[model samples]
Target: MGIFQPLNTPIRDWQGQRVWIVGASSGIGAALARALAARGAWVALSARRREALEEVASACKGETRVEPMDATRPEDFERVRERLLAAWGRLDLVVFNAGTYQPLRAAELTPAVVRGILDTNLLGVMDGVAACVPLFTRQGRGAMALVGSVAGYGGLPKATVYGPGKAALINFAETLYLDLAPVGVSVFLVSPGFVATPLTAQNDFAMPALMSPDAAAEAMLAGFARGDFEIHFPRRFTLVLKLLRFLPRRFYFALIHRLTGL
Candidate 1:
């Protein structure tokens, strides 16, 4: 491959592609489902709410399968994987986008709160990817996209629990890419900045570079077409955060405190 070549095969043709999105009930996942369906991809939508999943499936233009289940449960992932494999024969792409967040500070931390966020955001994604790894490796061709957050790029004041989970997820995606890329399986980490979604609706602080779910989906599609390994959007915002990672700890902490006022 050339030095400037895409890291993975560019997915420009969506016709008849079989895709499974874990958090497709609403937000970015739902938007992506609709976008892909319009391009003729067969989508399978999964989430905890059957009704919501059905609602999204109904809005899709092409074939769609609704697989409602909790992201926290590994059994749920296994069952859904089996169902999709049985029905579609093979999956061309699977996006582990299920995640939950709560604005938390160090003093406000509780076991329940910590577990709730980690179960869905970190452990859920790990297990879901585990379920699909074997199949993707066996098939020797497939794409796995993990929807993480730019917040994972570094520490922040209010994101006590949420930040850690996303940080772990980013690390997980890196390791997965290293292991899977040579095997012909593509691993993509989607680091989205403040996207308007039910999850972000809980934020008490002002979000920078806020984008609609549709806009976020469009950015993701563009990234996929370019075959970028890390598909981060609203570059004006994410690039600043990426740059912050290189600052000295004292400078970074002081800057973050000044910026967030938390």
Candidate 2:
């Protein structure tokens, strides 16, 4: 048998499920909303940009609601929560995909950059959890899918602040799963390899195993269908990273230097 069963529970039906996707203004979040809506899921889109959210919502086939707000602000989540509660009465799935990324090295590190990454990537996810946990616990069942990164698996060149923040998220999702799984709530840590999105477009180096946003979104839904806890994609790329994660520290550092020349 596989570690957590090859297929946990196939989500073959998506009719009438209310899914709230934060950061749906663009990138993977936008792609996910499009994919879910195609499958008949009613999606509530949230992001700081109302126009972007509305654009995505308008393109969807199923019923879509635009709830724009900043992920970094706690009060914004509170407002969105009220709207979701009033509209759907309950949320079946919450996807925390609101995040920002900037390539930084030790040479150019700044307190502002560090704090900015932590605030949006780490603290923002926590805020989403704080808002959703009570609702999920009250309902006795719900699911959370957080957008982490393969970059989180280990230290990478040009990812000074982004890497550590995502590492925290990976651990956070695992801890959430341990605590929430027993109560029927599922937690997923979605780690994507190099995907072509607005976020990664700023990268200077060649991105290996690069996939489109739509492809990444498809893999996520496929993983969700199987009720996977860690949903990573483009196995050709992610499998090697998974193996590298198990390497000894000395070997890991040496291999990273050899591969990335950083």
Which candidate wins on TM-score?
A: 1
Give lDDT: candidate 1, residue 186. 93
Tell me the lDDT of model 1 at 222.
Answer: 96
> Each prediction's TM-score against the native?
0.98, 0.96
Point out the worst 10-residue segment of candidate 2 by lDDT: 1-10
Query: Clashing residue pairs in candidate 1, if any?
Result: none
For candidate 1, the per-residue lDDT at 83 reads 94
Lowest summed lDDT across 10 adjacent residues in model 1 is found at 1-10
lDDT of each prediction vs. the true structure?
0.94, 0.90
